[model samples]
Target chain A: MVTMQNYDNIEYLSETIRVCIKRRFGDDCEIANIALATLGGSNRTVLFNVVRGSYPLRLVLRQETVPSEYSPFLPSDMQYRVLEVVYEHGIPVPRPLFELEAADNLGQGYVVTAVPGETLPKRLINSAEYVTMRARFLQQSAEILAKLHTIDHVLVPGLSALQESSDPLGAQIALYDRYGEPHPAIEFAFRYLAKYEPEHGAKNFLHGDFRNGNMIVGTEGIRVLLDWECAHTGSVMEEIGWFCARSWRFGRVDLAAGGFGDRETFYRAYEKASGNLVDRESSRWWEIFGVMRWAIYNIMQSHGHLSRERRSPAFAACGRNTGIIEYDLLKIIAKEFD
Target chain B: MIWSARMFNDPPNASELLLTVREYIEQLLPDLERQDKYHGLCCTYLLDVVMRELEEPPNIGDHSNNALKALLNNKDELSETEFMSSLCASIRRGDQDGNLDRLLILLTSHVSKKVRVSNPDYLDTKDYL
Candidate 1:
């Protein structure tokens, strides 16, 4: 469970990674460089370059550093397996290279080949360099999501570990209640969603945390969907709802589809790609649920900081951000638009 | 006996002090490394929250609770936590279904008041209502 905060142990990390590389690429392979990536809250991501014979290979090592009992993520090994299955299905994902062995003493994690792209939402949506990408990501992501949902869950072994919620709304409410911090807005949302719960659709393989910030965008379009930690089996609309949540829109509230384009364009593309009709009413219901889910997620993160499970200024700020998200949730549920 | 009071102090009040520190951090942010800079930005943002909270009246939460009480038709006085917790429980139990409109207004106001301090930038304050 060692985090990047203890970079003083770089020598130990270097040796371990060197051993890992040597095992895969012969003893002549040498670790050229390793640096800790600053993103992600639950996992430690180390970017490293290896010289295998005369070839230079770039790869990323992702480890579950701080495990939360309340976390909804699948185990690290499961995420790796999910990556493997998705990559094999011709999905645009980083190639899963190898996993950390128990004897490695670095906790559970795996390595993947690094792909070149930007994951920052603000830059991708607003920067002139990404104007073409901004126009294309909505359609591309829709197609990817549609194809992803069609994947056979049975193809991925041990997917039983993923929670297949019969009552997704109720399960989320249970998680919200566990934190025991009452927000009238979130509570009101819980009531609203329950009263108008849509008929459940056929369960599909969903990328649980699919959204703007979780995607890798290149100049052409979405390079890959990242963060399979929240992958689960649920209603397909759950993924769409999460994508259109106002929180994921960053600052561009108008472009609700991951702040890329209008929901109409995204929904139409998904229909064409998946050959399934888009249910607008059901999607909107999930959108409200998505907002409430995100607000509760903030509380969980802040609790992580307060309880000393792990402390970071970013996590502490999430406590106050919950109020802002609550404002958005109330607005959406009330349909109060400008 | 009255405690000695100074007409002026060497430093300013809480809000002004926080503003000064936040400005210093913003200026120092560019020189820090990537991770340190991100943390610095978060620190400055938290300081902004503290400054805004200091600017608000200390009894803002009590006012919000009173609004909730009136909307819920409760006459008894209750602490902020008690009011919010009970209201939340009632909503979950569907006891407040008939009063969704009134409850929505009250809840929106309640959340907006907090956002005004937590981060007013999130709201179009000119016409948040």
Candidate 2:
């Protein structure tokens, strides 16, 4: 992991500004401190808190490429730009403040956006403040999600550059195929998603990872969709399904939508806001896909540790859980499908 | 009776042993892609670990698969659901550290005889990996 000190170079900060922000905002701002968040992601998020007198400014800094010592797949500038476009459509994200290439004002590539709410996964919905406002959270989240999917898939931009498969079912099955073995756990999920593929008929917006972890849970129970890096154009059910995925329940499995409330509550909220029918069966199909998708993501991060360049036991030890996830999926599949 | 290589000086996290033990062989990734077949399995191993770790008490799974061994013992008697349910109940019953230590010890015994050789009669809650 590149330490925070390494990023404190004054020359680099000036260069980063020149390339991405200064061209737009000019050089009147002064950086107060450079800080990093070492959290659940593979990127180095250096926050530049600049002193613009009374009105302080915060810029989120991430590099297109990171040293080999870190995870190699830190999203590139291209990936960051794609996310910016997603944010532009008002996707409950910190609007893309700036995008830059190497220049004297900023080092390498940098992008900055005002920080959103504190990124808290564990406390958000569980906090007493969210209980009474629970229904609003679900309704607003589904409404925002509906808007995200309703956007013209073509205009969303960066679809081709991101990962895609021949068809929705094919993409899902191929994902499972990558992990061989007829283990009852994975097979159960595989059969269900394949057998009962959501017949949504037309593709729509998909927030590939929409759950408690990605969302910002706040006062109004508002869930600002975060992390468009994994966003894709797919069945609208895909996003909803992810919201209700078992893994995302975070122990409160009873409240399906990020464990905040039940499916009826979520469904009513979504349908009322989006003016769409609740596709219960299709949601089930996507929910199954959500678990599989999460499993794949987990395995990939764990696997990356093996590369000498990015070797960290912390990463590698995480790899040993496919079977367990598969086990959960299989049980769910058997219970519902068989 | 044996001291070799950098012994106690090593901070456990940064050791070469870390590289070998963790399944993510990103270094070996290139080799597997070239060899052509096992690459998928190799990759799957790492992904499983990453996803689970991201969830909670992350390191619990890999070092000790011993928690549910009793379920495995009655493999003939236990259906998949029954086994899983029982194990899940057992895991939820107490402190995670105690459970993890017990499981790790069991795994150490099963995977290697070194623990047995060093202390055959050792059996106590206090012992830890």
Candidate 3:
């Protein structure tokens, strides 16, 4: 097992919570437990409750993997843009409690915020509760997405300043080429992308990872849309197709959209709220993009576990997922070709 | 042998769970020639995660593309085949050079790019272990 010591020390973590809490709350409060969830996060996140006087304030530690601070969280500026805007729009997302302009007591640069709600590892997608509420949930999500897309750039200065992907298609080809680098399967996908490029030129918001799993849902509707780390302004339908991607179908293969809801349900809800017809061809093209994207991820990630620094059943297992992307792509393309 | 919580608790530990399922998979696993049970799990999980990721590869980023463009600076715009060969070559070079971080960065970059160009939102880091 990769030990926690290899990354950062507890003292650093403790100090981060203390400083951030103090910055947000006050100097007198005592932050305890300071438990960090290292696994399954884009950045380091910790759960802690602050004690002051007679009561305790519970909070979450959110570390934005700033490119300036670290290597992995590339496109840091974009992440900050999404986080700030989503939080501002009154969308149910983690409140933007803090931003790390400079590395504080915490060894790494991060942002801390209010913990939204309980997150369940076992998804509600396959649960009986989700059966009837499927359409309602989807409509709610689409309505929320509509509000997000209409987010006025003037409110968040950063998003307005952020540049659109200049050569999204060429850039994608180059990017995927790098990902599939050294892997023949990836190369094949690259070849597929080269000859059959889709129409680009989309200007709208893209919540890169908008899916059922990322959402923090409970007794009420979705408490908050979590994980804005990958948010950007790209093909807006990217979000729609992503929500409908087959990987999320869980075990309910019939529900193509997150494996429980139909596409029509999702689209109707989106169009109804956004007052914009989701271009079917654009959505179709993005769906193809979805498959190619999945294939690239599997090939590169699997190749990592296939390499030396990584050797866990998990990594090995992760690498194995590449073929599923290939299959999704084949299925998507076959239909288009026919 | 009967299952025991002493060692195997609710949602039995992955290793233990693997052992339990392996027992059942053994009947089918043995019929296949040359592939050991361990490799079968490896290959199967590899396929599983890959398939899951194919649903959504991690989003490709801007600067990462800049990095790839930087690495292949001198060469002519590379064909997909050339890109793969070069990537494989770079990975091999990384192995020979003893650069762990560079190799990881390369792998990460490639996956990011692949998802960007192909499925866009199909695969994500979550699908991987």
Candidate 4:
């Protein structure tokens, strides 16, 4: 595995990609236009083009730069397998390419065919250019999620390792305990979710972080879903609740459905598409779960910075951001808490 | 107390210093590459956090501490982190279920004060706040 220090050497990175491309395709394979993507925080995302014979492929190489033992994200190979399975099922995800093997010495990661579109939530919501996307976003997102939840978890063998289906709330509580940062609001929400655990909901394949920023939005809306590292088998409503969580809404709190439209519209579209009844009460429970998960994410990033595992200003901000998220979580669960 | 604090600290106080650096980064952002620009934005956000903290220190004063103290009756000597941690254990153990209504209020108030320091704009939820 290549250390991140050497990972930053563009010449070395380009050579590594070239070798991987040659190994996957043939000696004639030519890799070009390799550039690092600027958006994501945890992964080192690179955009490049590869050509062999008459075929041209624009690809994304997502490398796990900040590896942590206590992290909740699935291993890189598992994430790749999930993407392959989802793509095979006709989900609108990027086409998975070859995984970087141990021999490649570039560390753990994989390549996928890049999809075109803007992913920034603020721009997608506020821009006039995205008016069409905004109009179609709710229906499109709901339809995609509906399709995603319909996929058989048996198709992805790696998913069986995840225990989220058996006890989703317990799995999250265990994750929070592993992080070991205590928050009264998170503790309260944990109890609330445990006490009011939804009695009925089919366990379905979920895009564990299906929200605005994780999808690509063009004029049509939702070109492809990205980030399958958090994929798990869990209650279908968990996916819905995560999508509608206020943290993912950016500044458009009014538009609960990923800052694109109303929750009612999204729920109706999803219900119509998935053939599953929209459980509003259960959805509220999952929404609280989603908010607590967001707060836990903040703590994880903050700990990463504080513990000197991977220090950055962005991560340091997450420490304070946890407090902001806690306020949101408490407000949402206040009625039930009382 | 006789002299202005600004005179001893020099012209650029902590807030002004952060503001100047943040302004410089903002001006330099356009020229940087996309990756560098993203980092520059993160730097600006961190600087803003510092400025906010300097302008409005965390309002977990005696009143808030007392609220936390009241919740964990035996932990009068505990610091804020200890108090919160103890409260978390109590909540997890269901020992605080009877007092949840009161606990919720205290936790909400404390987190609200935190929000005021971290990002006050978040508290301006038009629908809820």
**Best candidate, DockQ:** 1
Candidate 1 local lDDT, A1-338, one digit each (tens):
65544433678788878877777778877897787766465677788898866888899988875564676667788889899999988888889988888766667889998887898788888888986777688888899999899898776665644444456776677778778898889889888888899997687788888998887777878888888887778888888988988888777889988889888899999999999988888988888888898898888888878977657888999999999988888888778741
Residue-by-residue lDDT tens digits, candidate 4, A8-34: 778898998898888878898898888
| Candidate 1 lDDT score relative to the true structure | 0.81
What is each candidate's DockQ, to 2 decimals?
A: 0.77, 0.04, 0.10, 0.69
Error (Å) of candidate 2 at residue A68 is 14
TM-score of each model's chain B: 0.79, 0.23, 0.34, 0.79
Interface RMSD of every predicted model, in angstroms: 1.0, 14.2, 11.2, 1.5
The pairs that clash in candidate 4 are none
| Root-mean-square deviation of every model | 3.2, 13.3, 12.9, 3.1
Question: Model 1: what TM-score?
Answer: 0.92
| Candidate 2: residue A338 Cα off by (Å) | 14
Candidate 2 lDDT by residue in tens digits, A180-202:
32232343344446556646666
The Cα RMSD in angstroms, rounded to one decimal, for candidate 4 relative to the true structure is 3.1
Among all windows of 10 consecutive residues in model 3 chain B, the one with the lowest summed lDDT is B95-104
Task: State the C-alpha lDDT per candidate.
Answer: 0.81, 0.55, 0.57, 0.80
Ranking by lDDT: 1, 4, 3, 2
What is the Cα-based lDDT of residue A260 in candidate 4?
88
**Model 4 whole-model lDDT (C-alpha atoms):** 0.80
Misplaced by over 4 Å in model 3 are A1-12, A64-78, A101-103, A116-122, A153-164, A188-202, A299-316, A336-338, B1-129
Error of 1 at B36 (Å): 3.0
